[model samples]
Target: MRGVSLIILVIFFCGASSATAQFYQTTTAHVSFYSSAPVEDIEAVSTEGISVINADNGTISFKVKMRSFQFEKGLMQEHFNENYVESEIYPHATFKGEFLEKIDLQITGSQENTIKGTFTVHGVSKEREIPVILNVLDGGQRINLSANFQVACEAHKIKIPKILWKNIAEIIEVNVNADFQFISK
Candidate 1:
């Protein structure tokens, strides 16, 4: 009888451990972009991006509005919307992807993982794989993810005016850091 009871207890604990692996989602996530050039590069920043992450299923969807972008100077901001990004037509960029592998919440602290998803920008969609570091906290109830990746302007059909070609780099680096709270459904 004692051995049987111990086996049942172990099974119960294992089942509970599996059930505790839950994920969260957030729309107020933050994202930013940066470009580098010799002396004329244009650098901008935006924090009004939205993101939804499901840690349990390893799915992520996010979007950012071009109009929310802010540049170092007013003139640059205007030019970015009018000439480069065409904010009036292609107003937003988005991404939908899932983590390549399941993140074990039991490990706690921070762990690096690969995220595989399709990124849409300037009306173009392309598959991309990025490395992300996830910080699991609050007994796996809260999550913070951070990653940096680069995208070529031409891949998204973003054309640079011949006159300002020297003012922007062909490739732009994007940085993402998002905090999410578990959503009970």
Candidate 2:
């Protein structure tokens, strides 16, 4: 009877360890965006983005502070926060979604996949399907993800003044690169 109880305990411990490995997260994900207008190009980047992924369920989430983005010119940043996105009112942008295909955590190397989810910006949420490249590195201890997508200013309620319309594009190109580490739940 003692031997049977010991076996059950070991199995329980093994199961628990594996379950904990399914969670991966990071707080320093890099996010950038660019807008090409007829007159000038606008760009900004934020390295304070936070993200998480559930390997067992293919669920993913990301949150980026609107005020954290840094632009080349201070005036550009000010205009972005005060007039465009209204960062004081809508402080953060978020994305929550799931991978359309199964992701094997044990797999090494890169895989192309699509994620479908809601992307909220400037207080507006829109459904988006983003294509991503997942690179599993260090024997699954780390995962690097890269994706490029476009967001429409009008769709997100970000208003570009007619006077400066030539300085801002209607559609913005966004890029994300995140490195996540496996964490125990």
Candidate 3:
């Protein structure tokens, strides 16, 4: 019957639409970096980071303004923006990559996965694989992400004066945390 065929077609389209998961996004993701040495302790935090995640395919991207990083000491911040990172010249840092493990919106749990992507900072780009934890929070409606990684100063072409070598470390520890909510587009 034509009625029966029409009913089946409507149901099929409804089911197909529900199969794909919604995209998640956040604007105030937090990112921090810490560098410690015997001569000085350096650290900064930036709460202006932005991130987007594709729940269907596990694709992720992030961007943060270099000048948004806040340091404890004013002199340190000035030196960092001028002599070290040159924030005036390179104003932003970004990452684009995908998770190795697939994310299922129907499930609610945490998965440890590696994200391989290109990281661009201070006008230099490098390929990196970072370990991260993805959690399906709030009954699969929200996603929580956290990652800790090390970035080498030389990799980003950040120059440190020889006199200040004792004050700054060669490698910096970066921390990222974000809670994303599903956004229907």
Candidate 4:
């Protein structure tokens, strides 16, 4: 009887470890952009972004459309879509990357890591390294990621008119906040 109980305990532990490796989650990630100038500051917000997060492996992927961004003023939004971003042509921006290898979330309480990935915008793709702060909660079952990065308008082929050059900055700062829930598949 003792030998049979020991064998059952070992089998249970092995199955538990394998089950922990396949956890996944999905969330509605929100992103916002802010432009600052000496005269005024403009802000735009977008919530129609989707994120697929793997809690067990700490991998994140997100997608957002250019048209989903909303600005404070309608005229500025129109100009942004028509002349600058050309949203009608290039519809979406995507990021695909994983955290630096071997930074396991199981051991770390809270981690500040860099996510290096390729970001595609306005039909242009560029390699960007974003500084991310992640909070591991509920024994690594929930993850909250926050980051801020600057995007150059010219790099993505966004052209600012001479009349509005001083109003809009050359680079825009983008902020992201995402919270994910665990999903078992």
Candidate 5:
């Protein structure tokens, strides 16, 4: 009976350890922003973003260097780093949030969900709930996420010159996409 008890205990411990949460992470996530006004259209893309998701708890977080964004015109990029986002002062923009509903991402396919969290830009943080689309691929070994949201310049104290106000939109459309492979511990 003692041997039987020891065997059951070993199985329980092994199962408990194996049931721990798993996470997926990627450093090459893509993030982009677009602003279209009557006078001008502006857009920038950044591939130097890092994203992580917990397959167990549905928690997600993303971070990107402000200077990593690239614009078609050099001047535009310079202006964005110096005058608007002030990359020198606040180097990175980050988002941290948790899923509102429970779902298993290990199953391959697409699922829509909402997440509530805080987004920090220009050193200011705002709580927002965003809708997201998750795509599972590679039979649960890979995952992709996409989210669309809007950010208001005024909300973060981003100042735009009066002359260029019309050239830039007060609200910017932000889009994010990230691909990740499951990391086993």
Candidate 6:
């Protein structure tokens, strides 16, 4: 519930207005990560991500529960929560920022934009500028956003044991896909 509340607070902080607000939101944003290593490849996906975008001003926020990620192997999932990310201490990863380019809510096609913001993971926050491909759909009533980025585990203080160094990659690939529907404030 804290995650949900945080998203709501983000929306309100965007200065939503009752008469002219243009908020698009969803609780099912898709977020995934991949790690390629010499010994093994690791991947996980979480469809339980929450996001809110103020289309009027291009304000955006995204949050995903760390434990919500599902891995193919039970052991990998356990290690992810208990070892890598330490889900008990840092329960969620979040991004908050605004689009660098002005948003055109009426655009019928796709647009390339860059979002600069702070990405928090494993209790560490880093400023990032990520490129995104956004498609306006349903006559501007829906927006689909996709982005791919890389993160260094060491930068976030996620340590890899010496024995497991070969099993995990130093850098991880992250992918985000989210579809948000326009909702009136």
TM-scores, one per candidate: 0.83, 0.88, 0.87, 0.80, 0.87, 0.94
TM-score between candidate 4 and the true structure: 0.80
Q: Could you tell me how far off, in angstroms, the CA of residue 148 lies in candidate 3 after the best superposition?
A: 0.2
Across 1-185, the per-residue lDDT of candidate 2 in tens digits comes to 32343233233322333544476777888999999998999999999887777777677878888999999999999999999999999998988888999877678999999999889999999999999999998988899999999999999989888898899999999999999888655
Span of 10 residues, lowest total lDDT, candidate 2? 5-14
- The local distance difference test score of each candidate is 0.74, 0.84, 0.81, 0.71, 0.82, 0.89
- All predictions: root-mean-square deviation over Cα? 11.5, 9.4, 10.4, 10.9, 10.1, 1.7
- Deviation of model 5 at 12, angstroms: 29
Give the poorly placed runs of model 5, Cα more than 4 Å off.
1-19
Q: State residue 42's C-alpha deviation in candidate 3, in Å.
A: 0.7
Give the clash count for model 2.
0
Clashing residue pairs, candidate 4? none
lDDT of 3 by residue, 1-185 (tens): 32343233233322332456466777778999999998988999998777777766667777777888999998999988988889899988888788888886667888788988889998999999999998888887898899999999999999888888999998999999998887643
User: Tens digits of per-residue lDDT for model 5 on 101-131?
Assistant: 8657556799898988889999999999999
Instruction: Give the C-alpha miss distance for residue 84 in model 1, angstroms.
Output: 1.2
Candidate 4 — worst ten consecutive residues by lDDT sum?
5-14
Can you list the residue pairs that collide in candidate 2? none
Flag regions of model 2 displaced more than 4 Å: 1-21
lDDT of 6 at 100: 99
The candidate with the higher lDDT, 2 or 5, is: 2
